[model samples]
Target: MPVVVVAWVLLILLGWSLVYWPHLPSGFVFGSGLDSSARASWTDAVYLSAVTLATLGFGDIVPADGWLRIAVPVEALLGFPLITAAVSWVLQVYPALTRRRALAVRLSLLRRVDTVGLVAGQRSVLAASVLENLAMSMAQLRGDLTQFSETYNVRDADQNLSLPAMLGVATELTEAARRSAVPDVRHAGELVEAAVGDYLDVVDKQFLRVGGSAQKIAAAYADDYGQRIAPAVSGG
Candidate 1:
């Protein structure tokens, strides 16, 4: 969001400089000496820049230069891309943050249930119930990621199906755990733990993949071909 704000500020200054600079009472020139008319116009330009950057466009200063005329449309062009990148970054990070919070909640709930089961020595029943809740939460996360993939088209290389496939495997494990009623509670508990571990691993990989995709899209949107995120080289 700050990046977007700064971009708009710079863009607005560019527009205002291009606009009244040509038609000022003193002259259309950079670094002109300040006089009564020049200072007032300069202040007006500053005001206009603030409004334009805020997208207020208060109708005070208008462009008059023919050759410098392209600034208005150019500012508009730059604004949209900056705004889009800001929005996309929010969209990518917000869901991942939400999922992390949800996962923490699920884990806490499972631990409470586990303690209760151990106290009652009805380990298998409690474990199964915990597994069911975890499964449901995982299913919800899968649905959220599916919508993300469809909206962003980030997984288009695999026909937008890789995440769905991974989620399906998680669902299958949960279903199997739900159906098993073995007498060995320890074995059932171990199976559920293994399944959860595997699901977590898959989810981690998917997150890495999606994060990479978002970084690429954002850099492209910024027109940063030189990889500004690259580590700086130091002299030996």
Candidate 2:
């Protein structure tokens, strides 16, 4: 997103510079006491445009003519809001992205524990506690998925840590728990499965209402998981 904003800024600067280039001789001026040999070129126009848009008044260049006087300040005024909005968007998005990554990590850990327990046939109290904790984590993750679906605006395919991926992980963990001989683990797995189902329903409803890139991402993720990751994780 920041890259998009930067591209837009560059394009804006280029456009304004091109518009001002032809008018430079009559409408633009360099600072006083500069050499007479210094004349406005395309490069100079571009530099001035950047300076004005960034509101970086180095004062080495100035607009001398009437129309340019209005134009330069208008560019400077636009600069303030544009830069502020970009910074504010970054500040808002970064934390949300960080939280999503953290949740993915936590789910990965839970899946690992459950897989190990299923393989080892462990029936200890510690295993039960782990199952309980996994169930709780799945519940929390469901809520997080709801928030993510509600708040996130799909910008691109760059965001790979999505609700669908997390759902796949949860499904694997539930299957692991179900295969275990321990009754408590089986019950916990059922709880996780139920929570996951509810969350998936919400995701489906959201996809139906707001069908776009997000829905495409979810469908692609599900297909990939079903064909590749699911068989590997399920030992099929």
Candidate 3:
């Protein structure tokens, strides 16, 4: 990500350097210390570009032409705010991913503790509430990923924090609830399943680009994140 940001800044500087190159010494006001040479070299253009983009107009050289005076400060404007926006984008992404990983951990703990209470055909209101909450969480996660596509490439250092690793657990748990004898639990499960399915569709459509069933897309997502989907039980 930093590479991309740097590349963008460099490309902008290079483009503006080319623009300034054509109008060298003739278009610029030079301080007494600068050489009064008739011809300017490419390095002079690059140096000018660097200073301008850095917003440090070192007085030794300044734009003289009307258009260049406007252009130089424009590059300065791009300098501070453009990089600020990029840094802000990076800062925002992790908070969203933190929430995503937190949800995965919550799902993991639920799976470790209760195997049957959620999906064992029991008509518990608590189970229904859990399912609804999971659905809402998954829905919010989907929205985050959609808005910030770059988060898909971020790798979780911890297995417990990897959403791809626990996504199946969510689906299967929701599946069990959908099969519950209780109507409320089943409805809640259905909503969560839809939520999970939408997230899967987004993975396939935006990032994976491997069109197929949800299972295939989920597998591709896991693989990209350096994980493998855990196999479901035969009956599950």
Candidate 4:
């Protein structure tokens, strides 16, 4: 996001520079009473552009010519909307990002337990409850991911909260179920696997539409999940 903002600022600066370039010699007035003696260099023009774009109006530089006099105000007018849009985008994405992180943490808890622990005869009830809760969490996460994919059109860089992480969690739950002698625990695991599969189908369609790096990332995730997690989970 910082990179995006910086790129926008640079583009704005370039546009302003071009607008001021032609009238550089006689149109700009610098403070400290150098209005007549000071010629507008590229640096001075850029400084004025930055000030106007930021709506700073530091009173250190002024536009003297008729064209520049009109241009400065227009630039200032554009500044507010551009800044507002950038801030709005960040604000809108923050909640989705927070939810993604929270889901990742919840899913990570499944990693701490071994199959034996989850499948034990005495702990069968606890294991069933855990798998049920995990399935519910994955369902909620699937909704969040769908919303995120629609909004962003790109995969998140954070592996912990990414599609792969969800796959890992689902696979782990399935493996535990297969290992368990208890029928309830196995049923709970099936629920989680079905939910995760549906979620992956949604993601697959989204990535296919987005294409390029996003498609590649989705493919890589599938490969990793299939090769490493699926075999163990399926008892193959």
Model 4: per-residue Cα lDDT over 70-184, one tens digit each: 9899998877777887787678677766665666555544454444355545577888887788678768767866755543343455544454644565565676787777889
Instruction: List model 2 lDDT by residue over 22-119, tens digit each.
Output: 87666766677765255558887898899999998998777888888998898888778789978887676666656655655555554554454452
Model 1 misplaced stretches (Cα beyond 4 Å): 1-47, 115-236
Measured against the true structure, the TM-scores of the candidates, in listed sequence, are 0.41, 0.56, 0.80, 0.59
> Candidate 1: which pairs clash?
none
- Among the numbered candidates, top lDDT falls to 3
Better of 3 and 4 by TM-score: 3
Candidate 1 is scored at a TM of 0.41
Give the Å error, residue 1, model 4. 7.3
| Tens digit per residue, CA lDDT, model 3, 1-236 | 55677887899889988988888889998998677484387778888888888877687878899998899999888888767868888888888888899987887777676644556657568888888898999999999988887888888867568888877877787778866888888888888889988999998888779998777888888888998664323232
Q: Which has the greatest TM-score?
A: 3
Q: How does residue 61 of candidate 3 score in lDDT?
A: 79
Error of 4 at 169 (Å): 2.6
